[model samples]
Target chain A: MIELSPILVTLKLATITTLILLLIGTPLAWWLSNTSSKSKVVIESIVALPLVLPPTVLGFYLLLALSPDGFIGHLWFYISDTPLSFSFSGLVIGSVIYSMPFVVQPLQASFDMVGKPLQQAANTLGANSFDTFKNIVLPLSKRGFLVAITLGFAHTIGEFGVVLMIGGNIPEVTQVLSIIIYDHVEVLEYTQAHYYSIGLLVFSFIVLLVTYSFNRKLMVRL
Target chain B: MIEVNYKYKLNNFLLDVSFTMPENGITVLFGPSGSGKTSVLNLMSGLGNDKNKENNSKFILNDRVIDDSVNGLKLEPWFRNIAYVFQDHRLFPHMTTSQNILFGFNRCHSELKPEVLIEKFKIKELLGHYPEQLSGGQKQRVSMVRALLSQPDLLILDEPLASLDYTSRQELLPFIECIHKELDIPMIYVSHDIKEVLRLADYIIIMDKGKIVDQGDIADLCISQPLLTQQEGASFILDARVTKIIEEDKLVELDCGETILITAESMRLNDKIRVLIHARDVSLCLSPPQDSSILNCVPICIDEIQTDENGKLRVIAKIGEQTIVSLISHRSARQLNINKGKQMYAQFKATAMIK
Candidate 1:
């Protein structure tokens, strides 16, 4: 029978990583879109580092940072007495960083496209920044949010190098689908590897297909 | 009065303008394309950032301080309650017409009824349509309604007719006039078009090269300052009261120091109006020609003879207390022996613009 623990762990990790990325990415994206500061390009390049740098390089640095004696890990050890390296939480942090650009770029582009003219118009109409963002900017960037969520979730689910380096193989904890598939292949169990590999392939394809088709219809309507 | 004193620095121009406008009626910021007219409007409404905090600026609206750089206090745009009607409409594209108009009203929690302006602006049918679905004129009408429904203390219209075709501009003029008649809110209208300035200005603030060239009452400025009329050549405003309506001739007789007749159909007896007469239309003669086909001859004693910017001699004259200007050739001025305090009959056609 096909096991469910690895599959559940992968979904859980992907969901948590996407949610955390969204929480931080939104304001960062808004700032990137509106500001003309000198450090804007620097921040943009830093956020986009994940798209170009190998995931193993990022994962290696994260693993070192989350070690028992490392600064972040030492703080966590003092607070909770649990090591961060090879933990599900550590994997979550890694995935969030790895998926940062996927979530931010789309949102920044859409916010930039909505532009300052509309915001200025709203301001004169007695709507403050938050109100205008909620009513005007948010509604207009619906497609951006959808695309960002899909790409972030799917990217994390398909992660291999970063998860292997940071999460390690801990059953029912961080032995996610990508790691399990790697295990099955190493042991020459092609059937088990096929089960997870085919599943992920189909899932990623369906998620992207739905997002793209939905965006097209929305584009036409708008 | 709404007083403004600001020194804003743009890329190529350092704007230094100081002017006061009446709390009511349309105050026009009239100037050419790159004269920092829109820049003034933006700064006055607090829609623009000063960038240079050291530059002192003060804006007082009827005793309430809106912007004071000395105190380092500048009210945000929303806090100022000044609505802006942009030339591009700037309507929320995602919303229907109904939603867009109600967006401001609901946000401001205005006590004014939207339906009144809805019916007045004639946008009731367009309530279900989006801004992209409407025509250029229709979009502007909706934007005007949106701005008015916000219940703002002040409204700024920045060249509302600049983006429209000639026919659409003509079509939208009456709605603009309707706003002046129906609302008591103070408005600052910016336009380079002299026609709009003449038709709508109660107070005029003329700008050129980031400086206030002149500012005063429109009727007073029309004759006193050549900057006001230099666009459409030279023109003058004459204060007159309608004395008679000749139905057969479709003309109205005005008592302006001297009697003048103009072809205005909808005029009543004793109705006070201002007549806009172009100086080019007036011809000077030594004596009043009674048998000529041209109508309305008024005797004007030349106040001064000055050369306008175009190398044309402009004879400034007065009839009673009101002034009338005439653009005559040097040969005609000499032929008529026009000199300071010289009495001459200024004859013109009956197509005077009575407003």
Candidate 2:
């Protein structure tokens, strides 16, 4: 029988990583879309580095940054007395870095598509910037949010190299589906690997299918 | 009074404009495209960040200094209480018509009720419908109601009727007039269309290449500014009062200095109206013709005569204190022997448009 602990850990990591990305990526994406500052390009390039850079490159830096003696790890150790290098929380940080572009690019594009005319109209009608974004921009970017959430969750589930480097094969903790599949292949258990791989494939396809169909209905209404 | 002084540097143009408008009635910002007409409206409403902060711009509306770069005072648009009606009718697509109208009314402490504006603009039936479900005319009507219900100190209309067809524009003009008449809120309307300007403007500020070329009362500016009269080679406005209405002929007799008959069916007796007479429509005669088909033949004394371009003579005259301009070819001027101080009859078919 297939061990279900790895599958559960993967789902939990993906869920937690997506929640953090949405919380931070929203304001970052809004700033990227609306700001005319000179540093916009620098911020945009850093956010998009995950899409082009190899996962091992990001994982290597994250490993150093989350070590007990490193800046972030020292703070975490002082606060919780738990090492962050190989913990579940460390895997979350690595996954967020690896999936930054997946969440931000779509949100930024949607915010840009909302345009400035409607915002100006809202302002002249006595709505402030925050109010305009909440009422006008957020409602109009529903499809973009759907695409971003689906891509972020799917990208986190499919992570392999970053998870291997940062989350070292701790059963029921950080041994996600991809890492467990790698373990099965190393031990020459092709049947176990096939079970997890097929599961992921079906899950991703169903998620994307639902999102695209729902997005089409939204476009019709718009 | 609304006093504005702004200087902004665009990509390839520099806009420098300063003028004061009346505290009441419609003040029109008239110019061609790229003339910075919309820029003035944007700066006044604080809708766009096009103001050059370093260049010392000052915007004072009824003694409140809304923007003064020298003092580092620029209020945010929401705090300024200015309403804008854009050309595209920027209603919220996610909200229904009623929600869009109340988006402003609910946000501000407004005394004007939404029901009154809804009934006036005739958008009550469209309340439950989305913006996309309404026609272009209906959408514009809803936007106007939305702007009015905000209880803005001043309303800025940036060519609100520009996107509609001629028939829809004609249908919507009466509602715009009612905003000025019933609500009595000051409005700054921007348009390049001369017909729209003549129909609505109480004060006119003519702009060209981002500068104020001329500005005055519409009656005075129509005779002094050639741009206002270029469509008909020179026209004049007569502010008259309706003295009699002949229901059988669908005509109304107006008295300026003398009684003038115009084809108007809706005007009641004793109503004040303004008649725009194209200079080309008026003909000069040595005496009033007895059997002419023209309905108006008022005696006017020639005050001045100037040669216009293309061998045309613009004959400026007066009927009491009201000014009338007539454009005739040099040949006709010589044939009629018209000169300064000559007492002549100006005959034309007049059309009265209610102000």
Candidate 3:
């Protein structure tokens, strides 16, 4: 029988990573869409680096960065007195970094589509910056948020290289569905590997189908 | 008074303009396209700024200094309490017409009721509909009501009717007039169409190449400026009151410093109107014609005579205190012996453009 701990841990990591990325990516996407500053290109290139860079390259850096003697892990040691490597928190950090562009790019495109004319109209109507963003920008970017949440959650669940390098594969903690499938394939247990792999494939298909249908309904109403 | 002085450098030209408008009437920024008319509106509303130029501009509305470069005082657009109606009718697509109209009212802290403006603009039926569901004219009307309900200290309309069909424009003019008549707020309207300018403007500021060419009362400016009269060669406007209507002849008698007869229908007595007569249509006769098909023959004294560009003589004359222009060839002036202080009968077929 397949253990359920890896499935639960995978869902929890995907959920937590998506939530954290949403909070961090919103303002960053808004700034990218509206700013004319010179550093805009620099910020955009950095955000998109994960899409083109090799997964092993990113995993190597994350491994060094989260070790007990490294920069982030040294800071965490002073606060939590627990090492970051092989911990669930380490896996979450890895997933968030690997899945950032999935959340930010769609949001930036949607914000750009809204454009500046509507915002200026809102400002002349006595809505300040924050008020305009909430009432005008947020409501108009509903499709962007939906796409970002789906892509970010799915990307984290399928993470392999970054989670392997940093999570250290501890059962009931850092060992997730993808890592369990990898272990079964390595031991020549083809039947067990098929179980988790098929489940993920069907889950991803249903999620995308639901999202597209919901987006179509929204388009008709708008 | 609304005083404005702004200087900015565009990519191809420089805009240096300064003018003051009255505090109670429609002051039209009239000019051709690319003349910086929209830039003036944008600067006053604080919707845009020129970063390449020096920041020594001054904008004051009704004794409140909203922008002063020397004092470093620049208020944000929301704090300025100025409403703007754009040419495209930029309503929020996500909100219904009622919600869009109330977007400003809820934030402005003003006591003006949305129901009153909704009824006045005749947009009550559209309250439940989205912007895309409304027609172009309906969208513009909703935008106007949205701007009005804000209770702004000033309103800026940037060619609000430029994008509509002729019938829709005709339908929207009455609502604009009602706003001027009901609300006491000052407005700066921009338009390149001469008919819109003549019908709506009480004061006019003509611009050319980002500079103020001329400005004054609409009646005085329309007659004196060649730019305004270039299209038809020296047209003049007469502010007249209807004294009598002859229904059988389809004519109306107007007292424009003299009894002037015009071919018109559906006019009531004691109604005020404006008559626009082209100078080329007027012919001067030394004696009043005893039997002529032309009806209007008012006796006017020549005030001045100037040579026009195309070998024509423009005769500036007066019927009582009202000014009239007659464009005649130099040979006709010589034949009629028309000089300053000479008395003659000016005859034309006057068209009544009722305001």
TM-score of candidate 3's chain B against its reference? 0.84
Q: Per-residue lDDT of B1-355 in model 2, one digit per residue for the tens?
A: 7899999875568889999999999999999999998877887788657435346699998889999988988889988888999999999999999999999998999998788888888888899999999999999999999988899999999999999999999999999999988887899999988888988899999999989999999989988887876564356789999999998998888888888888888777899878877777888898989898888888999999987765788899988888888888999988889999999999888564556
Higher DockQ: candidate 2 or 3? 2
Badly placed stretches (over 4 Å) of model 1 are B245-251, B265-269, B286-295, B330-337
Number of the candidate with higher TM-score, 2 or 3: 2
Task: Give the CA lDDT, 0 to 100, for residue B111 in model 2.
Answer: 92
Model 1, C-alpha of A12: deviation from truth (Å): 1.5
Residue-by-residue lDDT tens digits, candidate 3, B227-271 = 776554356788899999999988999999989898888878898
How many Å off is the CA of B280 in candidate 3? 5.8
Clashes of 3: 0
Model 3, A1-222: lDDT tens digits are 699999999999999999999999999999999988899999999888888888788888988888898898888887999999889998888888899999999999999988888988899889999999999999999999999999999999988888888888899999999999999999999999999999999999999999999999888877
Computed on C-alpha atoms, the DockQ of candidate 3 is 0.87
Q: What docking grade does candidate 2 earn? A: high
The 10-residue segment of model 2 chain A with minimum total lDDT is A52-61
List lDDT for all candidates, in order.
0.89, 0.90, 0.89
